[model samples]
Target: MKNSTLLLAIASAMLLQAAPAVAQNNVPIRKIKAVRPTTELTLLDRVESDTHRKIYQYNEYGYITSVMEYNKEAEQWVLDTDNSYRQEYVFNAAGQCTARTSFNVDKAGNKTTEKNKAEVEVIGDKTWERYYKEYPDSTTHISEAFAYDKWGNCVEEILYGYDSYSKMETIRTYNKREYSGPVDKYTDNSNYESFKNGRLLYYLKARGFDDQITMNTNELFVEEFRKIVWQTENDKLYRREYGLDRGMDIQVGSIEKNMWKSSESEFTLNADGTRPVKETVRSYDETGEVKYDYTSHTYTWDDRGRLLASFEYNESPSEVSYKGEYTYADDYAKTLSLREAIAELSCGNQIYPEDEFLQFGRIATSSYYYAEDGDKGESTYEWNADGQLTGGKWSETCITSEPDTDNPTTRTDYGETRVGYNADGHMAWKIDHSITENEFIKIEYLYDKEGIWTGEAEYDGDSWDGPWTKEGERGNARARKRLATRAATTPKFIDDMTDGSHNIENNDGVWNTNGNYNVTDGVVTGGGYQQTLASNASVPANPQYNYTDPLMPLEGEEDEEVFTNEAEAVWSYTWNPQKGDWESEWSPTEAKRVYNKDGNIVADIYDGNQTIVSTITYRLDDDGRLIEEIYSKGGNITYEYLPGTDYLLESVETAADNSRNVCHYYYSKHNYVDPTGIESIKRNDVSTPVWYDLQGRRITTPTSKGIYIVNGKKVMVR
Candidate 1:
């Protein structure tokens, strides 16, 4: 997510001011402590996984002396020489970090040092920092400096180039007093301040781009934000006075005509400080007859502080309000306990005895868009006790009154979808049905013994009887996306039980029954199971589903699936520079896979540098079931699943690659037959007596309406 716009400096200034400033304390400064991971889970597609652990050697003063990688085969920690990485920290006599060096190391254990230094100065509450990086290439050298105020607030920054000319400078100013709470719910566009001392007031930046010089300034006012006023001014030197001809006066006039632009916004707030309920923004044009009127935006939120609806409108005659409403599977009313439920219904007025209300006991059951030529729609959802989404429906009536009598009086269409999950809680199958025609499509997902989705297939109807077959130029790509339309529209929203806040807010015992899908904290370490391909096929094992047409099809060739193996084969990926992530789609800097003697892909190295960025060594059991995966980065995860089921028995993780932290796996006796039975024991521990405020302070009692901590954990006590 790189910002290409030159005005990025203004956006960055806004971001810096949004965060509150931290107050400068007179106490001894706390040195940054080195962070070490106790557990890491290797991601499937990315080159770097959280499971890859980097161990650090710390000096007596708690500063990191060296960092090393885990060596799998040797079962030892080694210096990071593969990428030629080395770092060391230097401190002044006052114990303050003064300088740091990061260079490279060759395979022969020799250092390739470069001149990189960072100078720091501190006097009372003020500080200064200067950085210099001189690489072998002179053009690569970088010099930057920063100044802080008495409250440790950044006041200025400067950047210098190899030449005598200064590249850029940024200056910042602050408000006289820190803002106190009861903040306006509307018109408050200010950032969440980080400093307890003062709010940010202005940001001024000057930079040289190519041969042109430009200046930008942003000022902020902290006047309760009942009304917001925003302005932007830009000044530029078209050309140096030494080079400009007599026509320079005319160029200067043109620049002045478009020198600056300004805007203003006003807003109204809800009872809570979540966000503005309504806002209006207006822009000004100085040089043209075209005048811009105010554009307004409105929003609505649920009791839980989640946005439920929103809309926008403009003052133009042709413009109409566009609105949308979001509905969740579980609302605040449905998540209440039996006791609280009765109290809510009674509204604190005892209409009848509480016992009578609970006599037989128990149980139960649980958007709009607009224009004058109007389209109306409604959406509803279904879920199980565990808050796992099971089904949903959306219907819309485009034209309420048909223009022609021969056509249907009303044009109404509906889309209904149902989903099924595997034993491990991962999506297994989904059916999308067109209610009007009774036509439906089904997609089945295939996975290995570890429950990682490997392949997918789509059928024509609710049952696998109807298969979708295609013969075309992009047959392979189309086959991969047979169910693409359905997957693209699948709702990412989860039910209340899956919201993570449910357990903390509702103390009444209401257990989740959706199976062990997203829950990972209590996953006991241990075990290995044989990977097997089940003979069961969602679709018939007929001639249609297979792809035995050609080993490598010619360009623009047309071939159909004749008989492809049901088991998922190899995997491929591409890097998406725009997203800064590796994607399954093709990319320029993609990795190439090579097969080993065992016919397994052992390495995936980058094409440009041939660097072994990712390596996966598999250890198969007698039955050829993948029992272990050895990563080049030294971290390995072993899996064991229940027979014939995707449910895992145990997954043992190493603190680092081949670290001694590996522990023995054990199985405890249980009454329930499956892994879901362990949910009782996996519940979060809440035995200790502890309390905390909304600010995360350990307090004796609650003093505000926000979140609170009790029994050593967060729990909403309001």
Candidate 2:
């Protein structure tokens, strides 16, 4: 991430406006007190979409060894550190992450480990995204860029996935005051806004997505939004919103009551004027199922609020309570396992929930909590001088401890991609990458006069490697293609490359030469990349699905499946050359395998060739991991793919004496059997896990070992 793009000066200007500013009662700021968020979830959309995040760290402390996490559904403790994360901390003589990194976790039998740093990058007034594990096959990174405004409203933010897929498979931006809600539906084209000078202004993008409604509803158009103060005989304040959904004209529909508005709405400033306060808000469903509710808040003393500790709650009568004395120590913040945090929150020990809507059965989206009975629990906290929490870990993986291995030998390299940026700080980019063990790659950008990226190239651990031609933009290179006859036997579209051939050397010490296999009218053809008959194979990530022999498509079925590269198909008959007409004698075998010009098949043909005739050739993923297989018998070639061993296919070769060769043995270090009685088989290569049996014997003893039951304590029988 680049600094200039974040615009620190703009943020400073807003906070430094000439208008009289609200000041905290002259109290010396201690460590930043507690900080809170509107809504928080362990995993967004409740999905474990982020499975391969890595971790990293810096600043003179050899502090945390690793961090891990368990999801909300976990019955017990779980680990989180499976990816690379970075931590930045300022230390005194003792090397504690004074300004950053604060959290802790609990160990099994009885010990507690602490973490003082998290993945952080502080540079100038802005912190760039650092401590990220580089992905193979990707020149652009999947990242979150942030910019804070005067009132703490996010001024600018971008979330994007930068690999080649669809034009907007990645890139989402959240702009405050500067833009309004997206009037479109392309995630990459979405925009948001704040207000300016009493007039409605917007953070706008001609291109981007606008939030859409479900099936039967109309699309809601954003009218206006932003925060600002106004004055008169009596100072007043408000958080305004403007909206429209299709046929309706734009109008102010709803708002978060009495905020930093120019005039007052429904609340008042008490004698304790600037002190922190909580205002509970509510919303309910038709059945009064207590759908939603949450406490609105204003932090009191800068660093004294406990953003992580949830206040107590009693439901039947409807009551909420917090702000209590710590039972055992001067310090109450502590780190716990994911389960520990949930337990405290479940009971009344932590998180402050505003109870105004107790009758409605609704509360704020996020809350905080600390441990209950022990000085030895899980969880940790960090505070700024004013006693405010800048940021802290949720689970240990939030500020975990793990062996450092930021630089990995493996990485992905998806070819070249272009990035586009709008004036409001919105960005869109495509990326090309690949995964290879023999090398590393860096993405390079080529810009046009407008400073927009028109070109993109790669540094293959060596030099700037540009693709052969430019796509549409200036510096980006895209391969060109031609759509041939659409009638019947033509492959969808042909990649009109100048020249090329498939030359592969097999274990038999033979370098096979390949040629084209294009179909024209009724004859199954040949022309381009060289491919053989018996030993050729398919490729991955991108593959061309072409039929070896033309066959009539199903009656009236224009489309059978989505395709990347397709050639016209035909019918196989018993004429002189053994090929004939449509319907009467033609039957369709759903496309199982696709091929390239060199006569070699491409992509995974798993589902297509499931009928399984005989021999097949396999195709690998971007990492050479087997993805599919293809089979051919003259004009009757078909493709098939199956679950495979990571390295090679495992099969039993019947020997004359009845002996079998076990080709592969998979291993799992983080192996765990779930409630379904099935054991997961991924590698532990990082954090270590434990397993137990009915008699309390440690069962995860390395070798796949003896017989083990499912979730029920396994009785190991040798």
Candidate 3:
């Protein structure tokens, strides 16, 4: 058929349909991209075995336009056909880049398509929209919609397709859910797995199962998702999936996860099902060649599913090559206890590596003393009641651990930390890390009355007090300790400020907030959160500045240990050379401030180069405690103040352009005014910070360590 004939046929079908309605899966999910706006970029015009050069092109809007694969052809730009793509986009009413679609185009411009459509809508101030798309179908296609929160983070994605041919217009659905409170520290592990149909696909075994498993993805593909039916001891879970790519076997897998919470925290799981415990894997083409593989192992548990051992397998023929097994007490089948587990594991020795006794003995842990023979001859370990691997030594010297179990009353001094179990089998304690050499750490965790770890905290009593670290980490003991520290110093800052408990005294001088930022004064400072402080120290260049004092603890104060608290910083300003009416308003003008006994501001002199630009005074009025702000421009006093509400009810401003701007503001639970009466514009967005250890290995907090030019590949610093 001619191209014109095909276009006519498509037009005819469209005309027959009449409305904007898509026919019953008439468009394959693949064609969705082509119908969108298409653009292209050419990367390597050609690559040469000896003189090949690389090129990269991007769309004007900063997106990838094209990447070309080429080979050397007389050392010139010659067409190479291997891998390339063309992208398409669509704009919504606002023209802010609503959608980005993609297609794989051959050198001839023939496009191989993927028929996925992302539906978007702005829920609030968030930029990224959620997503939804239907499964691909040449005849009957459906659509899915994605939903996002204010920060452009995906909240939920639902896969929806419709069977229009059915008399009842059947709707097929799958829903992926997300936690609403904060960013996912580990999405796959902490976020339960779900299918579009709302089925919980898989739950995590521990907080960081992905890190602990250390297996490759290819191996897991065959073991877990590849299995049809799976069983784990007496418990069982069922799952199912289908895809034509599975070849003749109709690749589908289902496994039963006998999920349960275990350990002091980090709910470690032990089971035997269709899923392999740990392994790396990769796939291959029809030719008998190595594709890629993940090293993986399947963990096994005792009769009651207590973690016993892990079985590792290789790729290709899929053969078991290594194993790490554990021994549990006979009573463990009924209940898992630390003492019983320790004794049972004590007898453990490596079953395989008969010649590599050293490798075998290492897995037993130090609680049950054993020796592993290696080049250095022997290695051993020791553990306190707390289960911390406190000792690791070679034949020459040893790092031994001594548990301060002297406190028989609580039997809680499991070394430096105090440990007691909640009804839910979770551990709680005050981890003391106050000692210098010992680094005595006290991790205290709080359980809801039901014994669920509700408040986890870590404390460094010397430098700071209260809670310094608190979060929900379910697996690693170290993580739990850190959480305890955070929980200890975790103040009710946000909660207290909401009620105006730490109301700014409305005094003089720049009211610097302590490291513990709980509330802001009444002044209209920019930078911090709350609706009013949009202009005060809101400049990111001075990110360390807050309207009120910060909550950083003095070093060594926790135990008289004078630590360098210099890492903590106060707000600083940079000089901008430009100045105008509006420009001066944007500038951090010089200001005088008077503080109350509690370090709260009582009165402030808003001075722009000692010109007495404004005066913000806090006082009691007939209605209630009120803040009065008087702006002095052109020798005229423009006053505005409200008794209760943090709003400017009077006139203001004397810019060079005479642009007398006046505005009012309000506050809510999620909003507030600073001590200077400035309403914060942006909220406290805690991104990953630049991390530094004693070794000075600096890693940016966001975990996006910029690419390190090492031998051409970017690897982690630690």
Candidate 4:
């Protein structure tokens, strides 16, 4: 059977397993470690290695106090002094972290006594945090303050950085919040207010200001300042505006820097003030005085409050427009409305009801872009019975105008992708086909018995049938062995551009050796120049050449010899002023070119030259692919390609002595996959344990209500 067919059959046999449902809990985990089994026979034979291990120490209140890391050295577990360091935290009786300290090793491999510490102070409805770091050569200090309203919503915040050398304190960021009504009022879940309130909550969360504590330490503060205004009518949010400012470097007691209004966004609700119907955004220049860009998006919804269509207009130095139409499966009635889903998620409720969720299958969308030359695209997705995406196809048509002409041309591009899952619900293989390029690639994943992804192999082919060659392999287990075998057997090639063919020709079209010729009906016409260089004995490095058209003789230069063809003008000549003639220059012996079975040049050897100054040898793989080249002078170049394809991965040029790299060039294609599973996880409904703080410090428990690292994701806990 063909490799592609066999792979597809195998993938098809692997039935997709449903993702294990998770239950919400508040259980605090004391310690956690990820270990791999030493043997493939049994998973129970797990071994702890120095590569990954961590120890946690916590206080009585479930808050972490300190952490120590160890590594296996000489078969003995010891502190990883070079990388492992202690981070300690101090908390008050109220379970709030009061201070934090971290240590690290210096360049000399010595653990420095110097440390960085952050202290926090909390008063009624207000908080302040100060951070100090001392290094061998420099010290840094930062301070932040926050104020909250009666509803426990932070209304103002300011951050400052101190420069000890200059004794200057610079304001880093500032933010202010205002609401037409109490912030708590937007949480009303009544049917009449659910839609508006849900949208308001979604918007607030997207802006990183939905919660009181999280708003104070928002990382966005480091990049820009914001002024948020929420307007409500009779407890219903009607509009919200966000104004952004940047370039905060004002010193304390000094005139404030001219803060540029970087961007602004305004959202307006529908007629009943139950859903957002329009959103407008504008961007300004660095000086904030000139408006450079503007975008407005208007949305329409069905009777059930499901998004139906959206239109967008953007003016960024030029005007462009976009439109998108959405279609849901007929069974969408079984699913919650968009507004209800958002509201439920905002209230920490599961967005999907187990059994009925999959009934809402496939969402087809069509989009259009309008500008100088308009284009349109359509995308359709397929979902399995379990709501897992099985395949998808996208096609677009674009219209472009010919250069310097009013004639317009239209081209269509299309692509399709298919995904298969293993019994563990992990993706097993994926096929991506670019119909426009007549190329397709497949990636098959390998996993251990426990369904842990160990490695993957990529294959490339022209069609969906028969031939499929492995192009790449990644991961540490089986892939490593395959790579070792390949290195031992595979030959290399040198992609020499001296021939002026191959990738450069295939990608950029026929070369225009000279601009004098015009191509029409595949026939070359017009005058062409043939130049020959002559090196002066005094200045060999500076050679001179002159362009001459064989058909057009020079007016005053009758002695100039004319050539009938370009090939005859290849040799250089010297001007003999004494004899008023041109003589052939002393030239090095010609190099003999050797070709391989594939008609590719394998070597170029100059036999007459005693030193063999320009000798080079080439090596190719079994499939006639070039992999390496050697120069007589000692310098060499090695090429790597995707395992089964002609696609070059990287090229390494070694110095003449082969001791160091002279140059390196890499060309690798990267495919981006959505982090969320096939069915978008718009909101995470499961609660996982928090093991670390935002600063990447291991924390047994969260000491404050802010953002914490949970399963490698930053989650905000209220």
Summed backbone clashes in each candidate are 20, 148, 147, 7
Question: Following a full C-alpha superposition, what root-mean-square deviation does model 3 have from the true structure?
Answer: 29.9
Over 1-718, each residue of candidate 4 has an lDDT whose tens digit, in order, gives: 1111111222221212222111101011111112222322100001122243334333223222333445556776666554444455655665456666656654333445535666666566545455566533455455555554455444566666555655665555566553322443222211213333333321211223222123233343333333334445452332333333334533222222433345555556666655556666656666555465354767776655555666767665234476666676544543554334323323322221111112222454434455545767766667677756676777777788875799889998788878788776756667878788876877676554344443455666667662775442112234234435564433111112132222211101111111122333433222222222211011100000111111111111122222212221232334343543334444345433332324334444443322334756566668765567767778876765434444333446677866643221112111122222111011133344546775789876665545566676654433
The candidate, 3 or 4, that scores higher on lDDT is 4
User: Sorted by lDDT, highest first, which candidate order results?
Assistant: 4, 1, 3, 2
Provide TM-scores for the models: 0.35, 0.19, 0.24, 0.37
lDDT of 1 by residue, 363-453 (tens): 1111555675466666555667864556566666665554345554557777766767888776666666667767666656555443434
What candidate 4 gets wrong by more than 4 Å, as runs, is 1-129, 132-268, 279-295, 314-320, 333-362, 365-371, 400-408, 420-430, 441-718
Candidate 2 residue lDDT tens string, 1-718: 1111110101110101011111111111111222222322111001121221112221111222232333223354344432212233444443322243333334221223223222333345433321122334433343444543333333344444444443233333333343221221111111111112222233321112444211111112223344432221222122222222323332222223211222222112223332223333343332334444454332222122223232343322134433211211124334332222222322312111111111111111222322221111121223334323222211110122233655424222222222233443323222222222222233333333233333233333322244422121221112111222234553322333223322222211111222233345535333333211221222332111111001101011012232334332322222122332211233234333333333334422222222334434444455444344443432221121122322121222334354433221121111122222222232223133365544556645435433444345332221
TM-score of candidate 3 against the unseen true structure: 0.24
Native-to-model Cα distance after best TM-score fit, residue 326 in candidate 2, in Å: 11
Winner by TM-score between candidate 4 and candidate 2:
4
lDDT tens string, model 3, 529-624?
111110111101111011111111101112222222222122332212232001122223454433332312243444444344454433334543
lDDT of 1: 0.38
The local distance difference test score of each candidate is 0.38, 0.27, 0.30, 0.43
lDDT at 139, model 1:
27
- After superposition, candidate 3 runs with Cα above 4 Å error: 1-288, 291-300, 311-416, 420-436, 444-458, 461-718
Q: How accurate is candidate 4 locally (lDDT)?
A: 0.43
Evaluate residue 225 in candidate 4 and report its C-alpha lDDT on the 0 to 100 scale.
35
Where does the lowest 10-residue lDDT sum fall in candidate 1? 1-10
